[model samples]
Target: MRKIKKICFYVLLGVIGIPSYAQDYSISLLPFSTDNYDEFSPAYYRGDIVFCSNQKSTIFIDYTDEKENLPPLNMYRVEEVERNVWGKAELFSKQFKSNANEGPATFNSTGSEIYFTRNNNNKKKIGNFIDKNNRLGIYYSKFNRRSNEWSEPTPFKYNNPAYNFAHPSLSEDENYLYFVSDMEGGYGGTDLYVCKLENGNWGAPQNLGPNINTTGNEYFPFIHSTGRLYFSSDEHGSIGRLDIFYSEKVNVEWHKPIHMDAPINSRYNDFGLIIDAFKKSGMFCSDRQRTSDDIYAFTPLYPMFENSQRQEENDYCYVLYEDGAENPDPSLFEYEWTFGDGNKARGLEVEHCFNGPGDYTLELNVIDKLTGEVSYTQAIYPLKIEDIAQVYINAPDTVEVGQEVVFDGRKTNITDFDIYRYYWDFGDGRKTRGIEATHFYTIRGNYIVQLGVVSREDKEGNSEKRGVYKNIVVVGSLKERGRRTSD
Candidate 1:
């Protein structure tokens, strides 16, 4: 028998500052998630998702006793309806479906292998009635590419016939497996454990230690690609029954977990977090609505720079340029456009472009279509406009060869830029850098004069360069040109 070890976990209730790279995520409940029954524990398998739900199952008869209305949890797969939205749900594996519970599964990198939690179906009868042996345990299955089906589940090595072991999450490399178990040698009602896969065999399960496991249950251990572990714990300070928390691995050890906070978490059971590869967006399960647990997708609200920060190189603001010809469209109701630069317009549709790139307050004063009351709403809109250096040459197009032609580069205009260097290439093996230059063409012919300007503003090498070329016809002296024309 394993020795039971108990350790105390001190919960920290204060909120910590979020990291700069961390995102302010917005949550939206998936459309397919129902209101009555429970649907939770979403895991990504390739592009689709596999989750646990207690929805109506044809194979299993609803168990009515202490638990009513809620059916046995089973694994179901939902395809993408359009982008993040999902389609109808269906049984993930027909062969693995049983009268017992099945749920909370994960797939290996290639998605060729899967591990799931299900109640032990093999039971013993005590009397005239049958014992279903409802203890949950992890199960394994393999996919056959040719047949397009999943193999019958086989009990995992760590699964026990008595104690419960469920909620399996795999590392990206599939070298370490994390799960929730209530077996002996845990700190609380349930604790998280990890087992290493060595030489094609899983080693002995090791407890995640006191930093993560607590006197209360810790469920749904998901290891992100960044080695950060996410789980739900009733032991830590939570807004409600259970809240999602994540801890990063430092110095080869797990640190104290931190609560995910509001929006992602709420005053209800929120758990089962699954992040994408980049860790920018993903989905999770929450019962914050007071209904059953439903799945929600989250994405970060990025700064104004959707692509690059260089203002002039990118389009900072889009000019809607609407005349409000279409009325009562609802979308155009209370139409007003206030370009942050103090320029305002009123109509069903209007357009405004920022004068230059800088921080501005774009206020939209919309009048109530029916009430005629005005409300000004403003948001911080950062605009950047590229100030391009331009060179305009003002010189005579035709000049006598012996005449002194003055080339001026002072006409170059660089908005919000200081011209540091001006270059002139006379196309006559002569080049000079200055605002103005005098050149005498001794030979009569068509000469292409080029002007190049360079402007530098800061030490960071934020510079702009622009060039212009002009064709000049330098005729010979009047008498020499007349002699050539008469011949």
Candidate 2:
């Protein structure tokens, strides 16, 4: 049983591609000063990066000793000054705090609501009472653009008490919240959970399931504006420490996650990912730098798949019929037949047929010995001939006065009858010729429209004739006094 499971696992890896397990993505590390203890958890907000760092100097001791126990991490922002280069880092509002370990921040699409992880001595005491191992929990704050400051941070409260939650990401619409938790009932050490926001409150948290979370920790999930998810995982195979990976939602379900390759991942730990929706560039945290962990900038190159190919060809043949009977002979009165398959036949009407059922772009290249260059090309869908007398008239059977109506006389089983001509009697003194004829009623009355067709034969032995009749009614115009009375 174990061997069979192992075989299935390997087959899955093969289908997704083995190189993805160890591929390294290209990245540029953020320049670091020697003063910082660590720098990580870079999140995107309005074309800038909001991250955490411990760049304390002798003159600036930011955190208290109790806060230092966890880590002296403070949130910072780096704006893009040029194409690839980032401007110098600056501290966010004091409401974010320079005194505790504050990091891993995400902003709503409008950059108004901020969610970040902050561990204070007071929160640590509560965490310790709940679980001696609980290190930190995520917090939320809102930025007031008018005041240019953030509101006081508040601990995010979820239903789950046994789990340690951090690294919160709000969906683009702020309707869903995704976070990482080292909670029980998970497939691995830590897993990603998403909770829907209902009536402005966070609802139940759902595990991202085995497709994303594994026996190892999965953290730092950043959902791009396009709905693709990026996170770090050690459970799935990685090049080194927890490497950054991405998964895209193709439809309702999430597709298999892909690893960002070599240069983006190394023997050192890498996490925290962010990307701008419009610019297509973003930043992540990596310990690949020489001494301490630092944030890096990267642009993702999406792969493309090949498209399926198709080919089609068409062929046509013809047969001639006269008096509802097959006829043979080429030299007769002038006749032209079009197969509706880009092929034509000339003589006194030849029965031209298509190779198959499809839209055939055809042209009737007719050469009148008298009126040269008489050509007619039309697009047609030639249905299979089922019976001989299946004639259809396209016009309505009833119409009002002054309305022009058309009558179409069509035959099914008689193939070689193309050289035939149509005769239409509008029953109102109007007569016309051709397969289709149009006429307008001059007076109000019920009239029986008639269409007659005669097929030309080569030897003039006999002629096949078919006709159909339909009734139409035309209404007279009302007088002005009667129209007003009706209204």
Best by TM-score: 1
Instruction: Assess candidate 1 and give its lDDT.
Output: 0.70
Candidate 1, pairs of clashing residues: 312-385, 312-386
Position 117, candidate 1: lDDT: 79
User: How do the residues 25-57 of candidate 1 rate in per-residue lDDT, one tens digit apiece?
Assistant: 787898768888778889998788888877886
TM-score of candidate 2 relative to the true fold: 0.54
Worst 10 residues of 2 by lDDT: 1-10
Candidate 1 regions exceeding 4 Å error are 1-23, 59-66, 122-133, 304-487
Among all windows of 10 consecutive residues in model 1, the one with the lowest summed lDDT is 1-10
Estimated TM-score for each candidate: 0.57, 0.54
lDDT of each: 0.70, 0.61
- In terms of lDDT, which candidate is strongest? 1
lDDT of 2 by residue, 356-462 (tens): 44554433343444654553322223445333233334467566554556666653233546536666666654355667766666466798766655667569667
